[model samples]
Structure formats: C-alpha cells, structure tokens
Target chain A: MKQNSLFLDRATIVSPHVNGWDEFLASLNCQDVISFEEDWRAQLESLPMRSRRRLSPQILLAISVAEKIHETLPKETAWVFASSVGEGETLNVILDALGTPEKAIQPLRFQNSVHNAASGQWTIAAGVKCPVTSINAHNYTVGAGFLKASMQIKSENCPVGLVLYDAPLPYPLSASHKINIPLGVGFALKPEPSANTIAELKISYCKTPNPMPFASLPQIPENSYNPILAVFPLLKCLAGSPQEDIFLGLNKDYGLCIKVKQL
Target chain B: MLQHPRTNNCGITHSSIVTCLGYGRSSHLLALREGRSGLSNNHGLDLQFDCYLGKVPDVEGIGFPSRVADFDNRATRLALAALVTDGFEQAVLKIRNRWGADRCGIVLGTSTSGVEMLEKTYKAIPENGAMPEDYSTRHHDNLHAITTFLQEYLGFTGPGYTISTACSSSAKALVDACQLVESGLCDAVLTGGVDSLCMTSLYGFESLELMSKVPCRPCDASRDGLSIGEAAAFMIVERDADGYLKLSGYGESSDGTSMSTPPPDGSGASQAIKAALERANLTPNDIDYVNLHGTATIVNDSTEAKAVETAVYRSVPASSVKGAIGHTLGAAGAAEAVFCQYALEDEVIPGNTGLIDLDPALLPNVSESCRNGQLRHVISNSFGFGGSNCALVLSR
Candidate 1:
C-alpha cells in the first residue's frame, strides 16, 4: 500500500452545533455531542436573499462551507461532491407527479431531482469550472468522498473541493433512510501545504479482515445515517491530538483509514 | 481531452452490456452491424407522450440466483443479468481467486437507482402516515443500492463507491476505479453503471420538453429531442490484458453555466476531451473514432459537435450510439465506451442511427453508415446534468 499525503488547506463544517470550522474547532469537546435536524436552515445572511431563496438546505450548507474555502482554491478546481441520499424530497415530488394520471411535473423540480443538484448550485455560486463528481456509498459517503478527493489530488496533481452532505428523504421513502441529523462538510484539499493549511493526512488502503465497528466511536451519532457525519471523528482527532487514526466505515468489509497530523 | 502520458495503462479486461438491442457484447455488435434501431414504441410507462424508447427486454423476467435473492431489485436484476452473460461473472470469480477478495473492488453508477421502488412506496403510503413494510429507502432508492447489491452478491469487498452525475456517472466511476488500481487499492475493479427507466426520468424529461416524439436522430437536421433508454453496462478494468481495449486516459469537466443546458461555447466538453487526450498522450489524430454523447437534443449535439470540431480532431469518425441504445442517462458513459471497444474489435464504426438528413451544422465526420476500417484509439464522451462532463480514450 502507498501512503498519499494531502494537506487540508482549509475546511468548513456546517451542523447544528457550529456554523463554521473555527466555531467547530473552538467548541470541540469529546463529551459534547450535537445533533443536526433533518432540514436545518439558518439565516445564511452572508449570501444574497435571491440566491438563498432557490437553494435547498443542504445546498445552502454546501455553498456556505465552500464559500469559506473557495477563495483559497485554484480558479479551475476539481470537486468531488458526495451525498448519501440526494434531494429525496425533490424525488418524492417528482414521484408524486408521475404516479398521477396527468403526470404534470415542474421543470425546476426535475432539475433539482438529480443527485448532483447541489454540485451544480455550489459550482455556479462559486464560479469554479473544472470538474465535479457527485457520488454516494451508503454510510461511507464521507470516507468515499475523501478517498475520491484525495485520489484526484494525488493522480491529477490538482486541488480538489470535497463536499459531503445529505438531508432527510420524504415520506415512506424516509422509512429506510434512518438519518435523524442532516449535515454537511466541505474541504479544500491540496497536494502541497498552503499558508492556511490545518492538517496533513496520509491515506492508505488497508486490508480489514474484521471491519471496524461504528459502535466504538462515541462522537458518531446514534441516528446519524448520513455518511457525511463520519468525518466528525476525524475532525475531533484533528482538533484534539497531534497524531490520530480513524476508520471511515465505507462498507461492511472495507473502509479508508487516515492518519491525520495537525499542521 | 488532455494529451498527457500515463504511468500504467488500465485495460478493459472484461465487460458486459444489456440494452434493448440485446444482451451480451456479440448481440449488441450484431445489431450495430445490421444497423438495427432499438428505439421502439414506448411501453411499460404511464406517459401520455408518443416518444420512442429503448427498453430492456424481459427486465421483469430477470431474477437473482437463489443465493442472492434478498438483494433483488430492478436495477440489481438488470446488472446481474448482464453479469451472468458475457462470462463477466466467471471472470470476476477467477480474478477473485487470483488477487484475493480484499484486492478486488466494485464501483457502479446510477441516476435513478430504485426510484421505481420509490414510486411504489409513494403509492403504498398508508393514511396512517406509515410507509409500506416492503419499502426500503436505504436499500431501494438510495444511490448505494446498485453497489451494495453487487458487493453482497459477489461477496468481494474492497473499495467501492457509486457515482450519480446523471449521464457521466459511470464514466467517472471508471476513472475512479482506475485510480483505485493505480493507488494499489485493488488489482481488479468492477467499474460501470446501471440506471433503469422510471416515471421520474421519463416524465421529468417530458416536463423539460427534452423528450423526442420519435426515435432519436442524433447529428441529424431532423432531430428534435432524445428517446431515453435504460441499460446496465459493466466492465472490469485491470492490468495486463491480452486483446482488450485500454482505458488510456479520461477527463472530466463541469460547465459551471447551466444545470440542464450546456455552455454554448462548448468549452466545458472541450476541457474534458482535451484532458483525456493529454492523459492518453495522443493528438486528435491518434483517436481513430469517437462515440459521441449525442443525446439527439438540439443544444447538446451542436455544442458537442463544435467542441469536437475545434478541440478534438474534427476529422475523427464520430457517431452517437443513442440511436441504437437511446440515451441511457447515467449508463450512457459505459454503454458508449463499451460500444467503442466492440467498434475497435469489429473495425466497424457504428452509423449515426435514425439519421436521414444530416444536420447542416455538423462536420462530415459523423457517419451515416457503419463503415469498416482499421481502427485503434476511440474517444467516448458523456456529459450530464449539473454540468458534469467526462471523456474517456480507449485504445486497442
């Protein structure tokens, strides 16, 4: 296995407990756990009212976080946007329309129903035109996103913007999506360190004979089915210790383990 | 695409495709050679529009092996149906024995996953505000459904993820699989996509006025819109292939212009094409044929045509397979790339299906017939919603 190092130049976390990365780090405590609501929306006072009116909570969260680090990124930045269940509410709306005889659907609703809706919104808002991959891997969305973002930086020698976010699915669809808290996290990952770099991480694909258990990690929420929340432990380690190991539980048999050292 | 040299080549060691044209690579190649359009009168949908579609045959009859019955869904069944054919399953088993399970991985892409199941769940919601007992949001409509099912069915787990950037999902998944292999994460990776047709995509496109009332005529002056199709295309990308097409290079670009409409300048698609060419370390001259994204839409065809005309080698023989397979949405990337593989093998460039009157705006390279010739490298383009675009360069 090869060890690839990525310097986390800047990151922003959006959850119920904290509004930005600085707040998150300042408020970081092992015992203090916070839960984000399924459709949490606060006054995104930084953005214009016109822009705020059109975006979903998850997209808004992504933009808010990306805005914090987008300036540090290159003009043509590659992005890997990952979410477990994307725009489930929008899908329900479209599904309801298709279920009827008339099948009258809205154009805007169909546009937002795609899994990459947030990626579209965030890119337009940020005005960065490189490339983006909107993806998901069950509860492994965070680790998968990091793996994808890190690989893009390593292989292509480019700075990558990684965003992991998810909101609640609507109705009977919500039955299987056990996520109680909707959360999002964005990072500007680079191959080399910048002045604003916060941490350096070495990622390796390790053979896990017995996959790591989520129950061992207390920072992870009980009802947190959103894969973005898996990054919470990594953030906690970055905030507390110099050297730490965290397994991003991507699937039952495999995951990405990162060794994070704060710069 | 970008023209740069790569360290090691990723090969299309094994692959399978199941569409309305038929199952297996030979079936598709036969249909392509015969110039058969899979576009047929739309059935199995509740839409009122008179558009054509490429429907997978016997999708309902596609069932799981009794061992993997619990992971059954329309998408998974479609994937397994293709996997069981083309010796893909046997190949995977052999690769597993050679590399061990931990060194083999799978990544599948889907735009709608189990949205059909979501529609069913929408119907079965009780008055008491309870979901149907059979409905599973996690296992059904979630993006992980296809990948999870494949991992469980195969019982081979390494690093896996699902990409869902509309049409470019599977192409990007192949790039991701190549990286996994390059990073020493896995020796063999199942990289492709499976997106089934559903009311959401059908009616959704109809709402956007993107659905054509007839079979799609890509690169044609008579073209109005696209006949959306359903498919499951999978390929195992590994090293040391004997007689397989190589995944030499790939490029991805986000238009950053519109959600649905591509940039009129065609620079976004050009970026991907340029990046892929650069990575392949080949000029436009090196690319013998290109399987265009040709969704038969007015704006997409014009923009992509212009992009290839200027940025890529305009003289490169290009044709859209959408006329035969219809626009497979998320599966289009892998579907078209596999079509390029078969095209290289057969030395026949697929004709622009449904094309009668060629578009005046298009270059002469868009073929009207399945011409036979010596072919080598081919470029496959897949542009999608959210402005995400990916281009892959394949070599024989």
Candidate 2:
C-alpha cells in the first residue's frame, strides 16, 4: 500500500478526568477507565483579556486544549477543527431569546453561533492568517477532521494541527442525544518522517461494512456522542498494540483503517 | 512554496444549479447573459427594512420521495431539485455502479443548515410555552443534516461531512472534496453547497445593515450594500482526466480581522489569489476572466477591486453574477464556479450584472457588457465573515 504517513510529534487530550497524554498513559498502566471532570471557566482563565460570556463552551474548551498543545504554534500552519454538535449551550440561549420576542438577541453570541466560530477565534487569537477547515459530521466528525488534515498534509506537504472538541448539550435537547463527558484531542502532524514520528500511519477511508470494530475506550459508551472518541482507536493502537492494522467504524458504512507504529 | 498549485486528476465532469432564477444551467446562464435579475422586494420575508431578496420560489411545493421524507427541509429540497436535473443524479448512479458505493463521498456547505426549521419551532415555542413535541432540530438545524441526508440518499458510505465558514463554506467544501480524492479516500465526490433563505439571515444581515434597499450593484460607483440571496449548486467532481474543464488550483487564507469587516488593502484576498495562481504555476496574465466575490457592498466591491487589480495585471474580463442572483452566501462559491464552467464551454464572458457605474479607482478591466470570446482559464473568489477567504482556478 502506498498510503502516506504524518509524524505526530506532540499531542494533548483534555477531559474532565484526564489532563494530557501522560494522564492517559497512567490510566492505561493502572487499567482504569476514569470519569472526566474539569472546571472550564478556571482553565479558560489562562487566556488573557478575553470575555467569557460571549464565547460558548465548545469554543472555550477547544481553544484551551489547542493552546495547551502548542503555546506558540505557527499561525501560518493550516488547522482543522471538528465537532459533532457545536455550541449547544448557546443554542439553548438562542431558543430562550426566541421565546421572548422582546428580548434583544445578543449580537456577539449570534455572530459566533456558526460552527466555525472556534476556528475564527483561534486565528484571531493567534493573529495568524492562514487556511482553516471547520467541520461538523455528526458522530463521524473526528474521523472526518483527521481525514481532511491527513489529505492536507499530503497536499501542502506541511505540518497541520487538528483540534476535535465537543461539550455535552443541556437538556431537553440532550434527552435524545447524550454525551456524558466533554472531551478534546489535539494533534500536531507533518508530512516528512521525523524523530518525533509516533506511528507509520496507513490510513484509508471507505466502508462496505467492515465487520472489524476496534475496541472502544473502557469508560466511554459504545454510542457516545463525543466525536473526540473517534480518535480513541488510534490512541488505543498507540498505547497498546502499535504494530497492527486496526479498523474503526466511523458510522454504519464509513470506516477508518489506521496502521499504527510506535516511535 | 507549493509545487504546481496542487496536481489534480479531476475536473467538473457534471454540475447542476438551483437558484432564484429557477433550476438548471440554462436558466442561470440566460440571466447572466441578459443581466436579468432574480432579486425582488423582500416583502414576504417579514422584514421592516427595504431590501431586495433573491429567493427560490415553490420550495414548499417541492416534494421529496416518501422514503426520505424524514430528511425533508428547505436546504435539502433545494439540493434534491438540482440533483434531479442536468443528469446529475443519473451521473452519480452511473459512477456509483462503476466505482462502488463506498468509493464516493458527499461534502456540502451551508450557512443556515436547517435554522429555518428552528425559526419555525421557536415561533411556536412562545405560544405553546414549551417546545413542540414534534420539534426535532436534528434533521433541520444540525450541522451535518445535508451531509447525512445526501449520504443516505445516495447510499454511499465514503467520507462525508459538512463545512460552515459562513459564505465561504461551499468553496471550502470543494477544497475538502479535492483533498478527499487526492488522498485516495474517495474516487468521486458530490461537492457544493445549499443554503435556504430564512429569517436568521434575512434579519441577521439586516441587523448588520449589510443589506441594500435596492438591487445589489457590484462594482457600481454608488454601490452601498448587498442584496441577500439563497441557492443550491453542486458539481460531480471526479478523479477523471477526460473532462474538458479542469480544476487546476485553489488557495485558502484568513484575514484574522473582525468578523464583519474585511482586511483593508486586500492583503488577505490577495494572498488567496496568489496562492491559487502560484499552484496553477501561471502568472496573472494567463487568466482569461475572474468571477469576483462582488457582494455589492461599498467595502466588498472596492476591496475586491483592489485585490483583482493586484492579482491580475492584465485587463481580463471580470464580473460578479451576485447582482443577478443576489449574494447566494454559502452556495455562491459553487454557484459562481458553475457559472464559470458554462462560460468556458460557451466561450462567452458574462458582464457584471449590477456593475453600472464602475468604480473609477478600479482599473478599466471591469466590464458591464457581455462579450463572446475564446476562454481558457478562469478563477472564482469567495470571501466571507470570520475572515475566511478562498479562490478557485478552473481551466479548459
């Protein structure tokens, strides 16, 4: 197979229970499936001189995780940010505003309601003017984001950063769909093989119902709403078996085949 | 920096259009030729402001197949309307059988995914004091609605997703689709955009005071603001080198500027144009025409004019079809690209519809009259809020 590979030099994961890859590594050693918890407002206080009310939870958590990945990552590099259900908290506010016809719509919140708000904020905050792809593909969002970044790495022959984040939606919207834990994953990728290369990735995208399902994250439900979970299989391949080809079903028919190799 | 602006084995093998001018390419091209506009008074839109709107009529009258009734929405309806025309659906079927269903992907762009349905639900919420039992925003307002619907509709299981970068969504979708093909993730992709008119945008643009009272006038000296519009446009982009038209290059950039205001001096826009041309490995002189992202706003027209001036040195025939179709926002990228596809095949350069009193500051390249000529290469620009910008180069 002539599939291209990208070096994953640095990475980070943020959830309620886990802080970074080191924590994940610890959890793997202990064989524990920990629950996630975090004080979003406190973590976001790290960023300077920004109002929080205008920003949604997804954008805040996303930027926070991205900031942790690379404090001074080049803004000129391309970015791919993906989510399954974005800004559900603000959606509830919007619906409340709609309920009160007299209540004025918060112009700032309304403008940032679009799916790409996080990407825009990342660019504006970093003051880097470059290409950005904001995606939302239901449960397939994380996989879609990775596929896009992998393609971009091959096309641009440059390093690309991927941020996949989503927060639990407040009910009654949550009644039908529930994502118990809010999670985010950040990855720094490059085209050329390097010392930081974590794996020789042979990634493929297609689905004729590949019966092989990669083992799911221990604590995470099989049908979790967290799009970030899509990358778990890759992480599993990294933390456990790093020399086998594993297939993960992104959806009913769409799947990702990643051959992971340890550094 | 980029070698040959992205080598590609794909081109626009088939396409379809559904806008205020009605369905199909002929209807759209005729308006482009005659400068006939689809923009009319925004009376029924329930807005107090005086604004012109280009809205596709009979959206409610259009019917989806019963099997896919659950996916019915204004945006999907518009997409199906186009998918059924120009043999687009037939082409998709033929390709699926040849390449296998899992070998194709569906990527769509939209600013208001199903927000219109949300607007309807919210309108009823105040009266009912609770969400309607049937109020399901999953199919109507979810960001993945169109992508999921198309995947289910086509029965294809390839990589599918939706991109929403305001007006630049669909243009970026094409870029994403091209990558999918280049990465061997998929063999063929249905790439385009669909955004149905809703109060969210109608009042949203009005709130920003970006909507014009009269019809939009692109590049016009007195151009004040934009005339908002809605449409659905798609092109069956495949990894086939046989098509006459070729998608040579694409460039993407961000202004990192304010959400509403574009970067002054055209630096952000120029970057994208330069990137596309750089990848195409051609100088500005090689471009035969430019499809401007001319939304008729005083700032957009002047800024884009300055950008075109800096990007293309020669006086290539340049125009903005937004004056005819109104600014189709998310779909405008693919819409303008489709217009360019027909322009290349017909060898006719469409005049800037609403560009009457061309800005004197703009070099004399901006044309107001349509002309017949041999066309080789053309580029379409789509820039949007959040400082998202994109440019596409297609050649014949």
The residue-by-residue lDDT of candidate 1 on A53-147, one tens digit each, is 76666667666667767778888678888888878667767767765778899998888788898888776666657878888887788878988
The lDDT per prediction is: 0.81, 0.77
Residues B82-176 of candidate 2: C-alpha lDDT, one tens digit per residue = 89878889988898888888788888888778777777766764443655667655577887888788888888877788988889999989887
Clashes of each: 15, 7
**Interface C-alpha RMSD per candidate, 1 decimal:** 2.4, 2.7
Q: Please report how far candidate 2 places residue B234 from its true position, in Å.
A: 0.7
> What lDDT does candidate 2 reach at residue B15?
92
Identify the candidate with maximal TM-score. 1
Complex DockQ per candidate: 0.64, 0.47
What candidate 1 gets wrong by more than 4 Å, as runs, is: A29-39, A42-48, A209-213, A219-225, A241-243, B1-7
Top candidate, metric lDDT: 1
